[model samples]
Target: MAVDLFTPLTLLLNACLAAVVARRVLGVPVGWPRTILVGLFVTFSIGSAVTSFAEMAGIVTGGRFTVSLSAAFILIGLVTAWVFVLGLVVLVVLEVLAPTGTLPSPLDLLTGWKARRRRARRYAQIMKIAVRHGLGGYLRGRRRTDPYHGTAKIARSLRAALNEGGVTFVKLGQMLSTRRDLIPAEFADQLAALQTRAEPEPWQDIKAAAEKAVGRPLDEVFAEVDPEPLAAASVAQVHAARLLDGAEVVLKVQRPRARTQVTADVEIILRLARRLERGTPWGRSLCVFELAKGFAAALDEELDYTVEQDNLRSVAATIEGIAVPEIHEELSSGTLLVMTRLPGTPVGAAGPLLAGFTAERRERIAHRLLGEVLRQLVRTGIFHADLHPGNVLVGEDGELGLLDFGSVGRLDTPTRSALGMLLLAIDGDDAIAATDALIELLDRPEGLAERELERRIGHLMARYRTGFGRGGPSGMFAELFRLVTAYGFAVPPQIAAAFRALAGLDGTLALISPDIDVVAAAREQGRALMREAVEPGAVRAWLEERLAGYLPIIQRLPRRLNHIVEDLEQGRLSINVRPLAHDGDRHFLNGLVQQIVIAVLAAAATLGAIMLITADVGPMITPDIRLLAVAGGALLLVGFVLALRSLALVFKPR
Candidate 1:
């Protein structure tokens, strides 16, 4: 009735033989080096196992049952560790060797080893460049004499260096620039200077690439092709042109030989990623290899003009209050994209609009953009993940033009609902609901206990609220991102990418208009829509539907609560607490923290408040000891009231 060890041994043998067969067929390295290491490890494991079995059997026959059992346990432990180490070695060796489709010879291993060494040297060089650039930037700022001017100059230099370093560095710089909490605010501000800008490619090269893409000369398809480029970027450049029908159009042309260059860069990055994963724990936690691969794929899609054109149209169709330039379908190709020309001032120049338009108009525009973005994220579960000032243009007539949809996100319905609840709960200051919503939205959707999920979410929510209270929008978002990235929150890659894009928008908006209250605008729009959604009748109807769906769980709440209490008492629950430092006066800090905590608690009181609150919490009070918590909370409440009133006023007029 007992299982035999020989059966498991046969499976192990088969696995090893399968690997050998695969390596031979695939033409990978099968030299003495790996053979020796594997042979030694296998011998060690087998010898240990055999000796333990012999000892155990001998002790059993000798009538020493306790000694035999103890020896058996020790043997099992040693063998388990040995097998684990060998398995990891085998997997890595296979990963490297399998790619080449052949067993590696000694020369191949030596070549790979040497290449790795050279790569390490190259990384050192890159690190040196980064340090020099950083320090040089600091010195340049100091040299300017005027602090502001000096910082600006250094920022400009850093931006140039980042762009020059190539695609990966540019993307990293862009991401880091938006994370004010992760880095010093000064550095984040400076890095924000690096937008999606590159020197335009020459006209001759553009024409040749276009011809190559379309499989004909530029003259064959168009009456006039502009030689001078309208705009340029690292991947593709844009040119203005005229069609036979007198249509003013812009042609997005892929950079000459960019595909090959990108491929080479990606290869380098992949190799570097593998090295980092092998050598550094930080790299492993970051999943550098996977991140690099994802970035490469995204950049590849961006290089295909046809794909970008499709994304542009898709996003425009999904989201209201935004428009994408019409793509000229007939004239489009993989590398050549022609779109209807749009005349608009860059959103970066919104300052000019402030001088001309009334404050209400400005607020309206902000509301439209923010609301539409949130709606797209909720309703269609899709959003532009690379929204920055340069990609958003303000027309002379005030129409918003959303451009460059190469990076976009699509959330599943469940995920979208959780995100909505997260937004609503945060605004309502309902920490418990926010925590639950975030856990469902962010972590592994299934196979998680409700209590465990809630505990972690609460901890994270508390950390974020604390940060938001102390450091405001820039701080809160930055810390949230760092937390998610560091802790393996299991956020899908697209969501992570979306976070980067939102951060970019935050930085750009701040630069354009410091007075623009982003959260307030978002709140005002969400509240007006949600107020109608959760009126007395609406609330009753919604509750009925949810209660119907969750009746089974609702009925068992008492039992669940008992289990939760037990777990908490036993200290079996884990929390995701993020620690933030206090920078303001002690009394003021305490008051602000208490107020945010109260807001969080109040928001949790009812789903209606969460869905309908229209207040900006970012700037309730300046960091000062004189600011009373009660007065600050009152001001926030008043702001919420006025915002709701304003919405009512707008609705009445419409």
Candidate 2:
């Protein structure tokens, strides 16, 4: 019977349904094999779908169709039932083999069914939320080439799903919002709201977490602790507190369930990212899985307050118009941070805070914010990774304060230098220089088309050189992300974080002063920083700090010089050369040279023989032989053979 008539289609439908039922009953992707049977089910499901489609096509084309839909269904059901009865008999064999874990992969039908068994519930929940929100198509990579490509509906839907997905997803969305290069501006704008507000954890849980983290009574740790959250977010919530002696401070308490909840969510995110990358075009281009892994690590670090404490202290002293909180290390732990409180409003919403501030003062504040962030990114090795408007507080005094050390990007000396160069080149419209600097900032992959990337960067520069709507750093950085993605390049996480921070600073600057041209201000500040850096005192300090690393070598320098001089003066200095260190290489080269010499000699011998034969010198050594002519002939033949052999040797493969 031709299975194309829908015979196999019915079997496949019945078997797949049976598998789904088993999974529903056992709480795993593979419960069908454990309970009833395996292969016949897989075979039936595949067979039914394939046969049904084929038969339908044959009928439409006026070709032979051996089976009716109803008959096919009946046969499929009967055959599957017979297979199930046989499977029951094999259950006894499985029981004996179950103890030894001997179930082979292919025989199991569904591969890696138990791989995610532990997280099956969360996995299912996430899938339901995504599907319910209609995010599957977007997840398959349907966004724009630029920030304008995403539609409002898609963005809104994603934001809603993220909100329902809980803390880790919300945080991820917030991070993506800054990455306009990776997402549409519509999506970025929508996701930014996820960071602005969320219901704070219950007061009871907050109090217990704070007290336990402090390892003392709440009263002992502070004069007063406010239950009202200063700010609520997914990772941690802040509270205003006062020290026992009456010093105002801020208390940052990690949410009680943040770690466990975020951990599970991170795992789910990683899985989703992996699946997207493997199955979708957009994921591969965006390097989605690597991005997830990087974000996961950053989220994990944020859960530990001690890391944030270290980050705060490291950047506490920098630039003139910015202030960073002084960490109270003695009372801090992996989950708690106590620090001096700075009074200010979020720069984005500093309505009343700007009352007394003059227009000039607001402009200065904007420059200060941009300059300070750039200074940290280029000059200092460690800088704030998250500099959103919510994280930067603008005071009445016009000074800005930084908050949230949970995410900071640290650059090694090389990366910092490369990034600094890259920014300066972009500002100057030197695309070639910018391309070179960008390469330095990344781990240069093999077979990269540097020239093509350079051309693309040049085009990007031309497009944005007039005026980047979103300001300089971010728009260009966003474009840069797209360019790298096009070339199949992945920006290292640290460098990417730094780029995002600078881009975010543009938004913060915009908040401080709407009229401020961020690009010009950034350019002015950048050159001014360069000037300040070259001043005598700053240069000397830089030189001194750098030279300190060479102290050991410096100490032995005079002695080394003296020994060199003495050796030269005594004529005892000698230079040793080893052009070819390996014996095999040397031998191979020597053979080549020998072959060349032999070829040349053979040519000379042939010439001499030709001259002898032409000159016809008179000589008689045998009665039947004309000695000169015959000798010439023999020499000529021998030379020809030698020349051919030399050529063969030269052309031979090893």
Candidate 3:
């Protein structure tokens, strides 16, 4: 068995060496991390191969075993020297063929093209080798006999496969599901069914991590700890426990070697991303290095118990009614997090949990939940990034219990401003401003054409408007994505994940009570937001002063216009308005200008139409634009009616 394993290991090492040569020859981005990993793999492979050869020699020599360690070292040195010499010779020959400081000869181009053609032809051969080695397990159906499998079975299979592939693949699957633009409906659908249900580390590993964190044995610290975990996730798992003082608590333990695995895997991924940067335009545009760094930071924070503890406290302080379990600081660390255990049933079964409550009471609870969400997102920069039904629970007293504070989002001042503006634009149904906010929030390319972006945003709004009545929640969400995709606007992975969490909440509410009004819940949340802005004596006074500041800007508008007129009279400012010079006939010139004007007008109209389509009603909508649109429409109607009467009088019999 050892010899069998060593043969494959040796072959793999040789293959890696081959790849190193290819990378140098092609000038591809095979970075230090890949080279290091390959080096380790090759070293191990060579060692294993040598051990197997020694064993075989021993068997052939009738158990004499005369091969010394020094002899093995000499053989390895000779092999290395031969490989190096061959590589140097190849390099020298290529250098001689090309001559220094000169362009490639015609023959070189022809040969290079031929080489590329050969590579393309050999691509299939490479794949075949992978298949031969069982790397095609992904494509091969494990249960091919289950042809009549239902959706649930298929979902299970997909989830199983994803879990087996590990964290990076699982995360990639989750990200792809949100990308309705790139992925097919079926794959996306399958991915949506996947949830983080990874197996927790053994109790011993948890205890070891806890000991490392608190600087004591589990028995010394905890009076009792349930051997079984309450929840298992990709990064960490939770278990109910009690402190030595008899305080009931829960322990969140990070998996052993998770950081090491993540570091190794992410390095590989980053190296691959760098390689892609040279191969694909989109890869370069995406700034994969920055993205990888951001992702690594986010994931590392998730593994940090200290971060989660702070997040929970921040959330509890910002959001009213909802409570997060208090963290036991003495027992907490980067790996082990101990918190007061709150009793509650999962929010999914809220009906049964809150069976004693009336419909009105339930509505109030819903409003509170919605209010908490809005406050966390709008009032506080730090918001609960995960808010799925599973993450929330309803206590016996009807208090909301928020769990899993590992993942949270932070918005900078600019993102906060953009978010506020986005909400305002949405409420007023101003598609152009909404689009601008979106562009700002997404950090869209500086070179992105403003007019085109506005048009796409309008289109998104249009989809929202048209789809709401006909398609309902899912349809509306899908429509919103269609517009995003159509415009080539990519939502960052975190933002996309946040949206998915919201969608899950929506789906949960739908399942719980069909009669519940999502939009109404949203509106109540909005009112709570406006109320929060005017909270105490100081806040209210500050708001009043800010309103006064705005009033002066509005009041000074006429004076600014007067100044402009005065400046023009004094020749301080010259008005220069001239139509483009037309060399063609009068009619043709008029028609060309008309077309240009018409196009501009059409663009403006399209923008308006888009806003009207995508605007959200109720509390989520800002009153500013809605009122403006209403007032504008009334004036336009009255003006049209007056014009018609005047025209009728002018064309009268007299």
Candidate 4:
């Protein structure tokens, strides 16, 4: 049977199919604007294409051929998108060279390979350690989730493997500890103790790195330089010293092999992240690729001591009754830093000193420490990210000081306010309010099931409100993160840092004052902020700021009104309207006009068709069929199709 391929049904169907094909091309915009443009282009293009092809092929061509062609087009489009995005991201990530900071030249390719060969020796040892620790299965994609419920043991094994992997993996494990939402609770807990401390770098390597950084000899710069390190960590080591001016100070020196070691490990980890993400459902759900990228970036930032120098100088008394150490600017360099050594033991370890204090006194110190953390969060917007006990010091008088300002979390005003509201809401057990605040604090989780999340939060509140059985601050946050993650949301890195800070402080409080309520302390701090915000002086300042914003408008209002009055009096009052220039106005008007015109044309044609077919007054081309009746039937089909198309366009997604 001969088929007319240019029929409205065939043309419309072809255009719609082509549009679906075009959407998979990916360069097309993601939403309505893209959909509209693509649909319009396909509609115009397919009409002309079908007409040209049908004229050449004649009416013997049928609808089945068009359907087959459209299906093939869609298949090819999807395949093209897959290849393009994969090829693009792989090329970008492969730019990183093993054991080197930048791309190696063609001449250095063999030399680079040789260096990497040496690195592979260390890498093989690390892998051996992983295999020995029973992490080989996980790394090899032979194991994913622990179906036997031995996550705790697996977590411990992973932590041990990382600890043995040396400085880089220890840091990676520490970074992973914050992602409680992604990893199991047992894993987060086990990895939480993954310390970055390593054996001290040899005195020669430390001294040489320090001297080179400062552009001077040690004897010329200091009265005495200690050979023994006071503390040692993966990236840097600290040594107690005395300056040329009889001042006691601390020297932080970067390890000589730190950069190269970290670079090689990061490359390996990234490759592992890719493999895991590709092989396991859990890896994709956890977004390990993105997590590794963020970890690498942070490690990159911490490699330079100058960044820490700026951080230490910038960590001021943003909270009242706190003080910061004075850094020696002349002695500071990207590879070395000199600062006054504070007099105190770590707050968490000063158990003997704190034992003498009354319960009220310990409570006060706890409140102050947590208050300082919150103050940094909402007020200054910059906070010490690693808020472990070792970073906090307690003097005999019970005053506290913060140390090691290398990693910090910064929040903008909106995020800070939203986070504060979230903390307060959750503490108060207002699930709806907490849900609202969470929507504001988090980046993704859009179009979230708000009522369901609130219900889940309500259940969480019921469970945790019964006392400290549900773990302390860390437990509460871990549960909260897991809940959000179940809804397929990724926790932002800054928010993760904030949660870890609070968790570390909770651990600190437990060491000193186990009876203290961490959530209550946070609530108290939030309440204090609220009180200060509403104080008379604060209210006056706020009102002044608000009024200042309106001052320009107020000044212009009178003149504008007077001009309007004069124009009215002089008979020059006129309103210039450009309603169509506005998007909402134009869209509504255009759609309304289009629909009305379509309806009129369709009704007139349909009525005319009925009249012509019923009149039976045209010349008969055949014995059984009249040309007039055939024309009327065609007009009727066209009018009905036009009406249906107009309806479809009206309902199409905007």
Candidate 5:
């Protein structure tokens, strides 16, 4: 074997540089000696791994292997050293270019670099798809030149791209479908049809996944596992199976590498979003980073199979007059879910079944479906956010079955109250109340013209009110979303999703019975809520709750008044009220003082402990000093916690 003289020299220099980079850039808690050792270890490992890979490749190809092994190792080490130096240069350049105080953390930068490389193929595909679909124009600052030119073609292309890109992109398209404010109406409408469809993985792969999840062979877990999947989507595929105990169930197996792929894609999208936010006017107006963050959070929740199982159980418990599948928790994992398979035809395929019903029977079915949706929104405040036709099933007995609880919407008390008011206002044709409620529901942006917004909302409501039977809930929701965007109001994501779901339900119901009135159904639901609110029992409970909250205040008032009266009678009370420059100044000053005290105590204790450790003394004195050092360390920890708590309280939003 021959060795190059420069190899050792270069490796030594690289190791030293790596040590410096680790301490400076990565903040590694190692002294110079330890850092040098780490650097040497890393270099050696990389060299060995690359050399072994090269030797294996050579042997596999029936080429020279043993003769070139040492040479390959040296060559690999040299390349690694060069690459490490280049990376340091790139990092420096990035730091220099990044805006002050906006540079990413070391961990984030490393992760992002890895993600960019990992998803390079996906990124290339995205760009190609975007250009093909005319989305590249937006990146180039070009608005749609012709509003009507090939709109359908562009919409179709974009939908195709989203489908091809994978689950995360499909999910992004689904979210964009609700953002009528950001995307054009035609694009939004087209993207709404972008379903999560993908070819099913092989049965063997699914079986392997199942066995891994259950820690047993497929035969032990199930008496018979179907070879064909019942349904397949980007996230998971469903297969009908019979358990060993004779329980019929469906196994929802997550797609291979779905989580890892989705995560990498999300990181790439987030990086692109950050770039757009910095570079484009459209991105700025839409807040692309915030949108990406929200989408990522939603997708993460959906990726967890356990979340879906919990959602199913919760809806089944609270919702009535609907069939939700029974989950088998014992046989479920984060990647594999087992649930009872309900027998029914998809609502989309139920046209023939619905056609045989009389007009009155169809109306009843429509009413039942609409009523259940309204109940989900009004009474329980948790509802299926994706109520598309494919997710709903109709049994032979005419029972409605709701499936796919992966994407659900939840409303807090305030949001639900606002929604109820808006629904009631719309039902009664009260434009003014509807306008007020809509505005209340929105996070109104600064510098908004309130009166103008109110007038616009009134006009919107009037148009919908006149066309109530003709437009239905779908039209009403569409116009409301349009108005919300027009006024620059940030509608909550959950609220927008709910509106989308309601619009879908409205269309579905209309197919069953054209005469079905969504407004009338909503009005009935509103009346029921009102009736519940004012019931004798409800009113008494409300009164008691209010009284309980006020009892302490009421009891303290008399004593406070007595003290005041006594002070006045004795002429001993002196009032020294002073006007504050700022309402928060007093609290700020108090917090500042507390933080300073804590910081001083912490620093003093830490310093004492450091001094004790560095100082050498006799054995008898050293034991006492060690005890003091321990006490100082404990005091320092306490001080740090108190300081952090105080700072948190001080800076937390009021």
Candidate 6:
């Protein structure tokens, strides 16, 4: 029996070792306890199944397997054990060879070779594109060595490289275009023109995706489907379709294999970001890893059509003025979204029409838009984060329509309150208050000088005051971002996204009504919002909610106080005061004497209790010396409490 059990036991042990190797050496995610349990079950089941099968096949006379089947099982277990031992040996060798951590582990070398080759191919492609566009010097670090020249050519080459590399690179370039503080102004301007539009997929592919999404043929769902796409992008394409119920809806069909391709590209980008963070000075300041993480999360959210649908519903409920297209939830899937087709002209295309509007009308439109934005920031705390002109539309009836609910911003109550305060401070020209508000919004890094930060903010605000009516809130925000970068504080991605959305809106508003003061408008609107938040009724409700949590404690306070006073009157309460300048040795000796006396008393009490238990010294209760034992136990308990208190005081830090 022992011999029979040995083979399966060895197999289980080998399986456990393999799991460890996969987890530690290869970076596989096999949780330890669960993996061990699974390994044991699998090993036992395999051995038992083989033996039983052999018995059923008449290969064994009774319950044992035939010699051949027995030998095969033993041989398999041996091979597994040998493989595990060999893996351990390889791990040791790799660790020894890569003591400086410059070399990959054996498992990584085997599995990641193809990934490295792919990465090299991509790098070569990027270099080729750069050289073809006369930006090779930039890629080779020559531009950094010299002064920045040929910014236009460099920006064009970068845009081309990103477009060629795939959706991940294009998305990254788009995000960087918004960050004027990080890149040069000219580069940012050029990259902002990088087109996100991709060539549309064929009609047959769209039809197939639609059919698969609705789990039926196209005719059953759509009466008339447009063969040509309405719009095409890196993620998905929109096509016009008429539902069977005569409702005109737009079908958003995800491109075939786009998710898989984007996933791979994002992984590659994340790896590069990690390397950059570890290897370069600029990378450390930029926080490339955190940026990559946020980008990945945003991209993942964008890839799911259902998330966009949910966002649309959420925004519709929160935003009152803006029009969001109603989604047909039953027809929506992970890849396909069906929504009522909105009827309006894009905000960018309405420039000629807007030019014809009266000045009063244009001012009203601008004010309405800005008011909605402020309300989103302060009241609703949910807003369209990507409000570029292309995503916004203006109807003939003067209603503003918001499109593409893929990206939305959310702010918690505290952040919303802080933002209101910041706007108020900026408008009031209280630079110190603005600085304080900004600090409260940020996770202030250690070693940052508060006075210096306030001074710098004051200087920036002074410049704004001198150049009043020049660039408005947008310019202030740009300068603030520069300051945040200069101070080595990692600006939160959400804050950056919010600023970008506001800046875009600011430019739009400028075009609509040049005379409108966005700062003053925001301040007035923010004050109203603040007042509403702290109204009497709201304050009363808030107080009630908070006080409810402490009601029990409040009710017990009187009784607790009475008990404390009684203890004081009975001389049972004592206070110990230790002076700062007291002699350390004398204090330690006094505590030590107290502890020693308490310890001796406890020991004597315990000894007395044992003797009382053995002797008939007190009135017997049920044939036991209960009275003396109880007295001794009580004394011991008192001594223990005193000893613990003395020891605690002796060791407490001064």
Q: What is the TM-score of each candidate against the true structure?
A: 0.58, 0.63, 0.56, 0.67, 0.70, 0.68
Candidate 1 lDDT over 433-473, as tens digits, reads 87677677777544555565455556656665433444455
lDDT of each: 0.62, 0.73, 0.61, 0.75, 0.74, 0.72
> Where does model 6 exceed 4 Å of error?
1-93, 96-123, 130-157, 179-188, 465-472, 550-654
Candidate 5 TM-score over all chains jointly: 0.70
Off by over 4 Å in 4: 1-108, 142-149, 534-654
Best-to-worst lDDT order:
4, 5, 2, 6, 1, 3
lDDT of 3 by residue, 490-511 (tens): 7765555545555556655553
Tens digits of per-residue lDDT, candidate 2, 1-654, equal 676858666665665665564334222233344543454544545445545654553421345445455533443454344344334334334444452233545555466556446468887888789889988655545442332344798789889999998878988998787676576667877887785366898988988998999898899879998999988877678999999899999988888988987888898899789877877666776678988987898788878888888788777755456788888888889988999998888876886677567788888878777887888887887888888888899876777898887788788878877877777887788989988898888756778898998888999888877667554567677777878766766666677788888777877777777778776777777767666766799889989998998999999999999999999999999999898988998998998897888788889889978887776458543333345755565566557655645644543334
lDDT against true structure, model 4: 0.75
State the local distance difference test value for candidate 5: 0.74
Tens digits of per-residue lDDT, candidate 5, 196-243, equal: 878899888888888888778878778988889989998899999998
Candidate 3, residue 344: CA error in Å? 1.0
Clashing pairs in 4: none
Number of the top lDDT candidate = 4
RMSD of each: 24.9, 21.1, 27.2, 13.9, 15.7, 17.0
Better of 3 and 5 by TM-score: 5
Best by TM-score: 5
Model 2 poorest ten-residue lDDT run? 22-31
Going through the candidates in order, what is the number of backbone clashes in each? 13, 8, 6, 0, 0, 0
